[model samples]
Target: MTTPLLMLLILTLPLLANRLVGRTAAPAATEAAAAWGLGLVFLFTASGHFVQAEAMTQMLPPWVPLRLALVHATGVLEIAIALGLFTRRWRTAAAFAAATVLIAFFPANVYAALQHAPMGGHAWGPVYLLVRAPLQLILLGWTWGFLLRGRTPKRMPSRA
Candidate 1:
């Protein structure tokens, strides 16, 4: 219900999935977790964008429509990526795509933090943007690592 609790769900879903993966052969739980996590992440980000839209318009040098459209589109993409990640066939691709999305959104986040965008006059404006941007990147990397490890052989340098 609250943003923090929702965030905790977003953060923990993947770990739960990993545990579920060990118990079940199909990894259905893992996929479900990814889907749910991403969906919530998407919803939260979109809502935040609107909450800070007025400040966004003023702070961004870019066109307002373009900025708004991009942010909204990103939310849709997040949901889509989550769905894709949950599918048996698209998990790998989705992981990479999700990482890409996180990377792409970094700029808007930085701008928001730098400008101290008013989240409807909320005091934690800068803190919210600052924390989420880096955390998103880290999470993306973590997801990537999760998707890659043990699936491919790592190369070791020869000892001469």
Candidate 2:
């Protein structure tokens, strides 16, 4: 299937399922749903890293070392992050790491746009990158807000 369609599916499937199960359309519920949705996105993208290695490597700039290896390693990281999101464990660290990962990969997106990299047989242009960049920021914010909300401080136990 095409990348855009796959992306739409990855992003919306979870949210749709959440609502179908009778979840409200409130912001908090939406954020929780998005955690699952974006987790699926990460897993899907990670699989592409391995399954479509050639296309993924094409997105990397020349300066990156061992492009193929980096692609696979990142796939592994994405899997771990996705699992963490689903389980709702390791919240602060996972959110921070996932946000950092997205920021770190922005350069590859820029390079791909500049190089006119083709994915699924269509060349990506500046307009594509323009649309994509903000999505990264939105993902970063989602990671932070959805996973890092309502911090609970450590406190000593009261004497019995």
Candidate 3:
């Protein structure tokens, strides 16, 4: 829903801006857009950790400890990772960290959907997975395609 739309908008806007400016090369612009877009997405989701703290806490099983603390910690992590994506030196590591975080948090999404945790759209029940799962895959693909892929490897020295 909103998440996907935000992702799409943020992902494209940079490229559009670049097109208008006609300054940066296309490939570099594309990479910049991707990183900026994904980083913003993480920041967006991280805000939910505080804005919807109780619902987020409920997403976890009762057996889990320090749910609120965990939510806040993850929020912080997302913010840090998002910032890291902005720098060339840290972009790859940030993308990898973002992917890892997404994978780690997915089960909580499943738990929330199953329990009908009364958060955004989770009330739709198991059917929600149909949408959620695909979105998760898309995020992972976005991370890989944009940040992880196309990295140039070091060349071996040529013998004379």
Candidate 4:
């Protein structure tokens, strides 16, 4: 629900600010802005790994051991991804990697929902899964859109 909206807002904030300032920003600026925004989101989410360890652990598949350790590792990965997104050299790779991580985590979300495992005090149900599934796709598309789809703007020859 709010995830997509937040992503959209994050995606557009740079361009919106540019417009407000009577300046037209490059399209890549919007993409960069989105990258930065997503980085922050991941960082915030990573905090929950420690803050709600027991509940997060319950969402894990039984075969997985050292639940808290796994959670913390994912948090570290999220933090690394966030930092990577902030770097011009790493944004594209980071975006692609972020999408991969998001996809990898999708199964846990499904498993959690199907089990109706409540984490952070919120109950999970079919309705939540319904929204989450499509949201995953959207998140992937958004990641790809900003980083993978666009061509770099061509520079014109400068005249003397």
Model 1 local distance difference test score: 0.60
Candidate 1: regions farther than 4 A off = 1-5, 17-40, 43-59, 63-65, 120-130, 150-160
Best by TM-score: 3
Candidate 4 structure quality by residue, lDDT tens digits, 13-126: 654675688754677677776677677767766777878777888778888999889988998898888898888887877777788898999888887877777863225465
Instruction: Give me the displacement of residue 35 in model 2, in angstroms.
Output: 1.9
Ranking by lDDT: 3, 2, 4, 1
Clashes of each: 0, 0, 0, 0
In model 3, the runs with Cα more than 4 Å from the true position are 20-25, 150-160
Instruction: Summarize candidate 2's per-residue lDDT along 1-160 as a digit string, tens digits.
Output: 2665566577778779988999888876776677787788888888888898888888887788999998899999999888877764554455666787999888888878777787542265677765677677767776666666665434458999
Best lDDT among the predictions, by candidate number: 3
Off by over 4 Å in 2: 23-32, 120-122, 149-160
Residue-wise C-alpha lDDT for candidate 3, range 1-160, written one tens digit per residue: 5665676677557657766787666666677778888888888888999999888998999999999999899999999999988877788788889889989999988998999888776777778888888888888898888788865434458998
What RMSD, rounded to one decimal, does every model reach?
7.4, 4.9, 5.0, 7.1
| Model 1 TM-score, 2 decimals | 0.63
Q: What TM-score does each of the candidates earn?
A: 0.63, 0.77, 0.85, 0.79
lDDT of 1 at 25: 35
Give stretches of model 4 more than 4 Å off.
1-15, 120-122, 150-160
Is candidate 1 or 4 superior in lDDT? Answer: 4
